[model samples]
Target chain A: MTATTDQTATAATSAKLSPYKRFTPTRGNFELWSWVFMRASGILLLVLVFGHLFVNLMLGEGIHAIDFAFVAGKWSSPFWQVWDMLMLWLGMLHGFNGVRTIINDYTEREGTRWVLKTLLVVATVFTIVLGTLVIFTFDPCIDPNSTLSVCTK
Target chain B: MTATATQPSSDEQKAGAVPTFTVTLKVQRYNPEVDEAPHFETYEVTAHATDRVLDALHQIKWEQDGSLTFRRSCAHGVCGSDAMRINGKNRLACKTLIKDVNPDKPITVEPIKGLPLEKDLVVDMEPFFDAYREIQPFLITNGHEPTRERIQSQADRDRFDDTTKCILCAACTTSCPVFWNDGQYFGPAAIVNAHRFIFDSRDDGGSQRLEILNDKEGVWRCRTTFNCTDACPRGIQVTKAIQEVKRALLTSRF
Candidate 1:
């Protein structure tokens, strides 16, 4: 009985001495939605990616058809423009979330994780913004003597 | 004594004619009282091919060195007292047969990782048990206790049958790379225990356990490495249990 009592006392003392660090309940379902989004976006990306590839590389003239002129002609239409935009956004977000999960898995220290994640956010944002601008602002006829039908019209 | 030039060939050994073979057991030992750092000590023992690793350890401790230390209670796999890193993998020494591991080469033995080593092949199990207790691994139901037992359907019991086999062996937890790096993560064993209670249809405290595991150091830390599943001596699919908990968390939140 005395040994049992001593053991209980020791357990109580250690429990008090080393309290578990309490993390406040996160405010929202960020991780849950992040988990869901990865799956949903992945499915959508498959169709958009394959369709884009088929149109550019297989539908008409195959690999030889892919050039600046082909790209410029495709981006001229709003249908292809929206398709490309969705692809860009979904692809970037999917890849970024994957890298974030990897970072969280490997990095142990708080400061190191913070530094790596900050760099990741910056890189992701820059690429997405630049890609979106190019998809929307692309023009094959910037030159004054351009011969393209869209520029002449 | 070393084996002579006339040692039995493979066919004779397989036919049960060979009485014994010499095995070199290289054990990583650390004593807080004497050692500055852990080191390996080699011992050669004559043993039948079918003898368990625990038996070899016993021969060394009983005859070779009086101070050599390790923990074993039932000396069977049930008690889970002798979980160790045998040959660079987490396994219960009592369950691993000598022949299963290549005894011709030196079989390495060491204490499980991610815990404070107390002495030779023994670690302080307080942290592991503390995590177990933190999950409130007990039936918590609301209202007055039923005079009769809380009845559960056969299907309901089957839902959690896989997780109930966990012996609280630290093998799965210690094998995890995440647990090796961060002590706070509620390693696979704790999650497996939580799963046992969580999926029980009779338990009402699942949401509470889910909330606790929903913390940053909870189920999200699992990288789906499957090391825990491979290390489990009880054949528990540890990674599947963890994924189930992760899915439960997602469904509960939304």
Candidate 2:
């Protein structure tokens, strides 16, 4: 018997849906892992972000204590350098993934999504790379006539 | 008709007379045969405070305009039909009273969004049903049927009791802004129905159903706006169900 109704059958109506193939673990679970990462990284980020903010903005001498020498001193140590690096990486990635999801949610056109996501990636890479470089390659003896301890040594 | 002309005052109500008032229903009208775009048409009907929005629709259809079209089967909220947007909220017309939704201004009545509109207040439900069918909403067992009925404990039944109340009304699904933006995503109703079966202890196909929902257009598309939960007439915690499914996917536990 012909399966026809009074109204015209649309594309979604006419097409026969393919059988559902059960997803195996062999297939990559990018979305699932990303979901987990968002939660896990969020918790870790809370500690890193607040710690960074407290040290820079609310610590010993507060905001005014933040100067070139202060930044140089902090980055001079491996622990602080690693801390800054982790903060930069996690913050950028978390924010990037959030924007990606926003783009996916709002943008309908494939071409538009591609362009926006490309820009997002480029901006994220630039920020993360530049931030990491500044964290590790930061110099304490940039000024030639500096009298700071590291500069003197 | 003026509002005061038919309105029974409090004194009249105290004398065992039902209070009546003129209610203007601003219904969205669209006929693909005639109109290019959907537009609103207002009809004033005399209604009691206890009158349902469905009752207003009936009065408008029967008395004012014979062409006003909508769906209503049970006339009570049981059949899940007559789910429409009343005052910009997805609700069953039969379940909503005239006074419940402020009747001072014109009550706006429209079809649920995110579905293909067939006519006035009627949408093509094939796609909605397709998503439901994709989830395979029946109880699936691994082995053949036994002679006796498959036994299920009260606790096991209670695990999925909340999701079992879904009436397939499309209220939750259509209220979702994500589904409105993208029709490809399996809407909340489909996911809710899937949750009903997935958490069933008797069903052996939870993993398979979970895998189906694990698609990009599946549970991941849910932004947890809680519009689905708010729109559910049966009070099903739709967003919570989706979250439960997401957690199940992560831990591979039911």
Candidate 3:
């Protein structure tokens, strides 16, 4: 019994040391960072999400304030533009990080990981690009001959 | 110490022995076409301390009740047929040993949640299979096949081995809360399989598969609960695969 117990203790100690010597920290840190991000983003998300909700649902005329004109009027201000931008970026990053955590937990194959991550990055870029373009380059009142709607007006 | 002094009065003392115990199993029973509601049926079976839940079920079926019905294949846990809710968590009945669970208490067995019940301990597998088939699971190569097997490196083949371990057990898919709510969302198993071919160096279907998976209801629906990972019998990292697919979609240009 004493001999067997000694062997077990030695085995346990060696097993603990093996992983540190064998595996290199490459993308695992990225996953760790992502794990940390979920909590941090979750907290920020609580604030950003609730703020957007309050502004949209509770402030002033509330639901009645929203319209095509309302959107045009809001986008006209730099302050609203910055707020919307922050919301878009934070929301997308939070969502992207959440999905990234899911991918690391599930996808086992290296090629599969590469291909899927590539696709995710591509989609994120496309959406962000298109959304940013739409946000900044707005033409509420278009004149057939003028390049800028504000200049035409 | 003399041999005469060590001798036992009974022959039973000469044989190697250990304490034995009795365990009770409470299994849920229901026949959809006949029964009004599901009910629990208990069976008392004698088992060794190291026996698995599957072993107990086998004993009950063989000795106590011949009518007890459940699905099991590849009793060693490779085949995913025996996945069920063991004490509220999805686990392969074959893989889960009774000793690992509460051996002192009666074990409770039930079918997986969020699926239509076909009978006791068996759920309708068609919806799960349908979701799997919709992902276009087969390999699609845009280029003509080479006369010799389309050459791929050992590294490239390794990319899909993890996803291939899925036995269509529905453990991962059924554990998903999103899949429970939205039937159209491509569940974890299908996405894992899709990731297999999408990353294959020899396969040319990346763009096409991506197009199919890019809908509002596709990969975007996953909520990253990690339940599927915990439930997977083969230990396939499911959440990682979904994230990789999402990453792929994000990077691909329209």
Candidate 4:
């Protein structure tokens, strides 16, 4: 419903719109990739997290059977290890991206937002690194020398 | 032409009297045929404290330069045609009084952000209206049409009453940073219009709108910046409406 008021025959409007009071969006396909990652990882996380909960809380002796040995029992197998690792990586990445969106929306000052995002990256990297190391290098048997229990003979 | 006898002649007028002062307006000027880039041109207009920003532009066009072009109609906020950037904020000029802003300094007026600026204070609204059209923002009833008027309760009408007031001014959409960065995002105005139809009890298009909004560029694109809500002349909770559409998509419920 815009009114065509005071039309000038010679003058024309600009086809370009320069940024005003807005931060330049992430360079390249960062946002597009980030958007794709959210949807993809979200669907994967739903299955992984629910399946994990079902195993830990609904299968066998349910929640009561969960202990250090129970965790050791699961991590002993490469299949379970990979499952947990996938879950760990996907969950953290999804959560980190979601929080990053929140920070961008809420933080008015550019400096504060940059700092918060930097912190998010650091924390996510540290957690993923530490989690992956634990899953792959975990010792099922408490004693390294022992050939008993879940240890290899 | 007769000069106004009651108009204040000086800035020394008291608060109760018409306090006339000089307002420097820096308007963004662009002529595609002549200039390669947009530039600012300054104009000084005498205005009373009660005078709206539209009056200042009118003065500049009528007295200073007849070629100073812009869009305005009804001289009131109802038509939603005079929306422009008033000192960096998207606001209807007719609704903004000179005194409300810091008129002591020069005021910068530009066309709203995120749209292709066609001329001073005008943008090609085709893209914006295209998004609005894509959503199919109309009541849809799949079942047999009722011979009588379809009845709706008060609660149903009140649920979507806020979004219904949107005048499609493009204020909320242009104010959004996401819309600015990527034009593909459905923008807040489209989502808001869909919300109006989706929540209406008489409308059968809730599921259809929800499905359309479930795409990657739909409601999920809204990061809750609240800029759209701030820019909305009708005071619609734009971000909140986007959230509602998101919830509807997730739950598959209206």
Candidate 5:
């Protein structure tokens, strides 16, 4: 244990209101990992999300041209497929981690934390699985009943 | 000695009122020289609604037990020395009013968390100060000093004005559960102090501060739990400052 010292004890000291109590973790670097994730994901999300938005909203004809064809046209290429897949994974992970922090901060009771984080994980997993499948496996041409140009070609 | 405690300062003395109620202070006492663990010692002090918890401790230390040890220099809320867990909440005893808390129950006072309890309410502040020093809590100026003064805009100064009010009392840091769990994490006070200079347009050292806080146990370790914000004696937007530092780190790379 480091030694304690006093500096100018005659001077005035500050006072403040009480903060809420929390249980401190005795081990692990989970907090460090979470912190790094926020920054890394934040930076990546800026690029990935802004790129996604620009392509969808600002590129040729803007929102008016967007349809099943617009989405299929982009996803058919390997480059856009990788971009959208990265966006989905990073966005979902980043958002869920952020919410997990909120859950830990506000939820006092174990039951609240347990149930909410559990639901968050379930929702996150389901979305990620469903979203990834739709991104990679989605082929308009495979749906034989479709009459769209991209589907036929 | 069943001493009648002295009345509060004239400014604090309520007019046309009688101070009659008794406040029982359950103080934690420990002496590493003799005692194995700290124990609670209760003292009933004569007080009023306007009286702060610090007044009761003074009464006990003065007339009841001079052996009772706690650190308090400024009886007011400036020094940040009297921070303790008063009634299970971290507060500056000088600023905490007895009436604000339930006076009916015995108010429990313990040393602040995340530091070694040396004796009564005193804790080892070395680690706290170490983290403060590690952050390089000072202005770094690479430019030549002007003959008169380094000119700065009022807008530039105001950008970091909130963090400039920190008293470094460790109330915000000690209150952080993160610091309590892992002392390595730069607690709110250190980050708040770093923010004071990092956002200052006049300061040329923010890049270094940004780099230092980007460590594994640095700003990233902050969980945005708001414990430091709530516990800040100066009412600084501590969590917000930490966030600002985080943004600076992320944007500095670009």
Candidate 6:
């Protein structure tokens, strides 16, 4: 028999011979999903990432246009605000899941894994909270008495 | 009479011709309740040409002693169990054959370093999972459901695809020297996971996750030993992911 057939036969025989089995991973399926995800996300990333670059670099006065005032200008508009918000959320999730895979593959200690992942979640949350705050609560033109330049603007 | 006797002896020797080879296995054994200190136990097992170290362990457990214990879920190398220090290197016990480790000399097997040993070859895994969950490894969109399916191109998914293969085995994390001393350091595996979505186009939490990782124990703690990469069973390019995150942090105007 061919190798494929031989493997099939062996599997069949093993199944017949043994009734109690514990935690046999359904191989090939997880990998298949991961492969599909890479292609799909990679394409979306090209658009979102490149669009971000183009707008920041080529739009209006281009790279020279960027400054504290420029950022204030973009955040002021709801359209740009939504666009940036989407970029931040998507990029972090994708990267986080990807690294999760890396962690599962490498770390052997159960305690260590738990500790490290917990830290990752805490940090991720802290950043998201702080960043969203900065994005939303941003004050471009502040009172003249304020110490910050952006606030002074 | 002498010739007859010699011939008979030679025939008997030939009839019981089983080549006996001796292999010494030095294993580290620890029991907190029973033993005051951890000690090494050596076993000499006579194995065949096709015997693996796992097989030797079985022989030792079965014939020599029964107190020896280690974690083994799948005899095959899939479930991420059986990872241990084999001859001073991190590898799965079931995947490494005896001949490959040391053909003539004794082979040493110990629990992975940088963790508290619960018993023989079993380390506490709570800390490792803590770091994993800390990264918030989930989709956190603005709760705005798309009218249709969230459309993403093939290339967008491909950017973080290689990184998603991690199995959370802790081989990479324990292998890290930084984690050994600085428990607060996020370690390589957590950073790699954070980088996965941080760079993804579909996900939106980049700046948020980046800010979290930018802390003292975050991505900056990575010394780039490449031990996490080398020890990973899945062949993940861990160092590259860390570098990518570092680049993202540097270039972002925010």
Q: Pick the candidate with the highest DockQ.
A: 2
In each prediction, how many residue pairs overlap at the backbone (N, C-alpha, C within less than 3 A)? 0, 0, 38, 2, 9, 94
B147-198 per-residue lDDT for model 6 (tens digits): 9978888998899887888766678888887677635567777887888888
Q: Per-residue CA lDDT of candidate 2, range B98-178, in tens?
A: 999999999999999988788999987877888899999998998788899889999999999999999999999999887
Query: Cα lDDT for residue A21, model 6?
Result: 22
List, residue by residue over A11-43, the lDDT tens digit for candidate 3. Answer: 567545532121332222243345446667788
Off by over 4 Å in 1: A1-28, B1-18
Ranked candidates (DockQ, high to low): 2, 1, 5, 4, 3, 6
Worst 10 residues of 6 chain B by lDDT: B2-11
Candidate 4 lDDT over A1-153, as tens digits, reads 133442432223322332221133322335545766898999999999999999999999999999878898898888999999999999999999999987765665668989999999999999999999999988767677755475775
lDDT of predicted model 4: 0.82
DockQ numbers for every candidate?
0.21, 0.29, 0.02, 0.07, 0.09, 0.02
Residue pairs in collision within model 4: A13-B118, A13-B119
TM-score of chain A of 5: 0.78
Q: What is the lDDT of residue B180 in candidate 5?
A: 73
Clashing pairs in 5: A12-B74, A12-B79, A13-B78, A13-B79, A13-B80, A14-B77, A14-B78, A14-B79, A14-B80
Worst 10 residues of 5 chain A by lDDT: A10-19
Report the error of model 6 at residue B60, Å.
Answer: 2.6
Question: Taking the tens digit of each residue's C-alpha lDDT, what string does model 5 give over B15-120?
Answer: 5565558988899999877999999999999987689999989989999999899989987999888999987778899999998878899999999987767788
Q: In model 6, which runs have C-alpha deviations exceeding 4 angstroms?
A: A1-153, B1-22, B48-51, B147-149
What is the per-residue lDDT of model 5 for residues A1-153, given as tens digits with 9 covering 90 to 100? 122323223111211111221124323335556667777999999999899889899989998989887888898899999999998998999999989876765665668889999999999999999999999898777667888886566
Candidate 4 residue lDDT tens string, B1-254:
12334654555644446557899999998876587988999999999878999999999999998877788888888888888899999899899998887899999999988787777777878678877997898889888999999988898899999999998888999998877764766799999999999999988888877777765556777878899999998899999998888767666532
Q: lDDT values of the candidates?
A: 0.87, 0.87, 0.75, 0.82, 0.81, 0.74
lDDT of 5: 0.81
TM-score for candidate 3: 0.62
* DockQ-better candidate, 3 vs 5: 5
lDDT of 1 by residue, A1-153 (tens): 998898789767865654333345532456666778998999999999999888888898999988777888888899999999999999999999999987877886778999999999999999999999999888789777987787888
